[model samples]
Target chain A: MSKAEKTLLNVPKIQADFPILHRKIRGKRLVYLDSAATSQKPRQVIDATTDFYMRYNANVHRAIYELGEEATREYEGAREKVAAFIHARSPNQVIFTKSTTEALNLVAYGYGLKGPIQAGDEIVGTVMEHHSNHVPWHFVRDHKGAVLKYVDIDDEGNLRMEQYDELITKRTKIVTVSMCSNVLGTINPIKEIAKRAHEAGAVCVVDAAQAAPHLPIDVQSLGADFLAFSGHKMLGPTGIGVLYGETEALEATEPLLGGGEMIREVHLGRASWNDIPYRFEGGTPNIAGAIGLGVAVDYLTDLKMEAVRAHEMEVTRYALDEIHRIPGVRTYGPEDVKQKAGVLAFTIDGVHPHDIASILDVEGICVRSGHHCAQPLMERYDLPATARASFYVYNDSDDVDVLMAGIRKVQEVFA
Target chain B: MADLRELYQETILDHSKKPRNFHEIAEADASAVGHNPLCGDRVTVYVRLRDDTIADIAFVGQGCAISKASASLMTDAVKGKSRVQAHQLFQLFHRMVTGKPGDPVNTAGLGKLAVLSGVSEFPVRVKCASLAWHTLEAALESKKEIVSLE
Candidate 1:
């Protein structure tokens, strides 16, 4: 087959891997454009979790039976796979949490509260951060007496590097930002920002919830001291998230929760903590979810992150060109498709986002409409909300066409 | 099974485009703000009451077409009604939009408000249609707290 033919053929084959893509909603073929919120799991990921429960379902680490040993190996093997996926220095740096929100909180409390952040210290974040990354720092600022400064974004939703340079200073103990903005889809310069933060004696944290599923992530190359992503936002199940911290960074922080499997020796007066990753994981982890996430990583690896990214960029370029053809459609994010992910947040003139969303819903086109948990960003732009349509592996130009048709329907209904 | 045309009727579209009584009441006796954090819809209801009767009513805010139209309809419905009558109408309107399984919906007194009965089909939009009424209730009761349909 020709290269173009091969690529076009792979799109349907990729769609086949995701079972939910075939389902109908509201009697119309489902056009899921909200993958940035949470991606539909592939059959491989689903089967991995089901297989674990069906074959070897036992408590990991505590029990000494054959089933227990198998479960432990599978859980730890998942960690190793995730470590390799992110190119972490070792598997011991990967801490499992419920979601990206919890993972970010683990760092905010475990690292910030323990000692890294002190009274009057400054913590820098961006205006484009999702609430998951924003709210945790608010707690640190409110309780720890640290000053929280937000770097502004330009009209194109690109980070204002001048303001960012001013925001990060010697007193800045930590600088946290999202690798890719969930709303604007701006691909941030994490490696450059990490270098700047390091030069200023600040540890850089990255919220990779949006980027991990789209871009090729290398923690070592990115130089982020701590990185976090959710499994559900990728192709894995819910209730499983990864927090990849540098070995030194993980060792320096305290555990957020205290319970079984997290401690080495409980002396009644003072308890000794377990090793790096286990110490952060306080209780019985999400074994099934972890295994599922492992399989998801394997699946993505087989597809090749580069190819996936290329496909998304192609789809995004097509969407941008087509969506712009609709008069009165104002899209947010960089004009250059290369600078952003497949996510597109936009507003139709004279139409409320909720109304747009409802109109699209009738056509079985799922798009997120609201402030998108980034109220501060919404306030920054003086907008109530925006209708966001995001693309993923299974999505193609046809899905974008359906979305355009739905949007035209919204205009007609409102007109 | 829900129809979009039913939700966005002709009267609704008209009211949403040129909402009635969509200005601030300068000499307001009672006023309260209603906010729907989910969709960022906000409505401020103001009432100038003469004894128990609403002498004048107005609303000022930004929201979706349904919410803006509902607010406009609500102000027109409750303007001349007494406090008791307005409360009763609020209850009727609420039930109509919510479509409570057992509640009786009497639309005889609801003129333009009857158009909003279609909101019942779209359960998620009930909050949008009732935000103004909730604020009106709070205003009539002279509540100082902001009304939030969380």
Candidate 2:
């Protein structure tokens, strides 16, 4: 193991941050390996939600009362923390939507023009994006009559940037990809690709949903015109997320959802829209969710993103080394552990993925089974689905041990 | 007490290791494909018939324990039975998998298959346990190339 692998944190304090870890399930400890779906919130974020509800629960913006003013300031302060975390220039560029799904859809619907996306104008994307990225892009393509293209992935799950170079040209309007593949956990080279897209005058959108929790993200450094990520995936509350769009990109788009707050003036004949961030944000925001997300951000900052990534690296390197030892077991993605994130997908020789998942479940080990929302990628590999175990900061070597013992049990059971 | 998990008793494991009638019958009367997308298990079943009676059946594919065991058990269960009798057995086998106890698919006698009844406890594995029967039923209903329960 290298220095990055040895950089694991003194993470004993992490259990205290998440209260639910104290709870028992089926008379045993809960070994949550599904952090890729949603993270368990820290106590601070949970308490923050309770505090907001109990003390100063009021709508943000255009409030005169004391509670409302306090609520507004706190909410805006949360936005600043988010902006700073991602290294954005200002909070004005950050748009708070329900999730990465809604954020990507807002861009697909709002910024897309009919004429620019003529009969054959190309929109280049990759095969590894989550359904949150795939479906919305399809919605735009169908409506605008644009051609959608996919950049091939190598057998190792790395993007074929050379194929991307051939596919992208003056006709390419948008290039969207996942920063970290959810199923394969391959951390993509977004900065280099974003530069490539910019050279061709195409907007770049990065789905940073899986990256935000494990890896430190800097939107400006990545040079993406728009990026989307969900809070729930980052140890925050569900139904809240951050969408970072370049100020110029936001200014060029129309309002996504029409309602009370996202407007300047309305008439019997026509209605004008609000500015960038507010324009995209519709009425009655997820106030409590946002506040909880702010608390989650604080919790992660306190833990240190570098430490989190280090611990994950230690666990992943250990897992990758051990999982292949089983007879007939197969793993997918970049062979270099450093090139991967916390997710590891594999198949056992005699056992199917669902059978593998079921056998693991008996030992109180949780894992995901199936195509993992990348059916096209599955088709590329000629596979139906795979069993995946993903890690986060909360996971430890013990989790990996439980997983190892569980796989051994499967061998014993089938023996 | 029969350990249903031991339905794959030492005997079942032996059968799975060297599956009997695990081939394609060139002069088969009907054939079908079955797939389980969740686990990537796919198999083809071919049935050879003489007149209206069941003659020979074979299967080929890659699968897990439940599917391979079920296929091996199926080849053992259906040889020498007539088409109508095979449908009756297929119906009972279907009910056992789908958890519909009183479906018309049940026949009076399926002794060793009762071990498979324990499989109904695991809903997801039911398809894995019944892939061959579903393909047999599909072959009886339509083209025998591949029938999907996916």
Pick the TM-score winner: 1
TM-score of chain A of 2: 0.96
Instruction: Name every residue pair that clashes in candidate 1.
Output: none
**lDDT, candidate 1, B1-108, per-residue tens:** 667787889899889889999999888999999999999999999999889899999999999999999999888888888999999888878878888533444576
**Per-residue lDDT of model 2, residues A206-231, tens digit only:** 99999998898889889999999999
Query: Per-residue alpha-carbon lDDT of model 1 for A1-415, expressed as tens digits?
Result: 1112234327788889989989997788999999999999999999999999999999999988999999999999999999999999899989999999999999999888875789999999999999999899989988899999999999999999888778887899899999999999999999999999999989999999999999999999999999999999889999999999998888878899899899999986899988888999998999999999999999888888888888888888888888888999999988787899989999999989988988898899999999999999999899999999999888888888899999999889878
Candidate 2 lDDT for residue A200: 90
Contacts from the true interface found in each model, as a fraction, amount to 0.75, 0.41
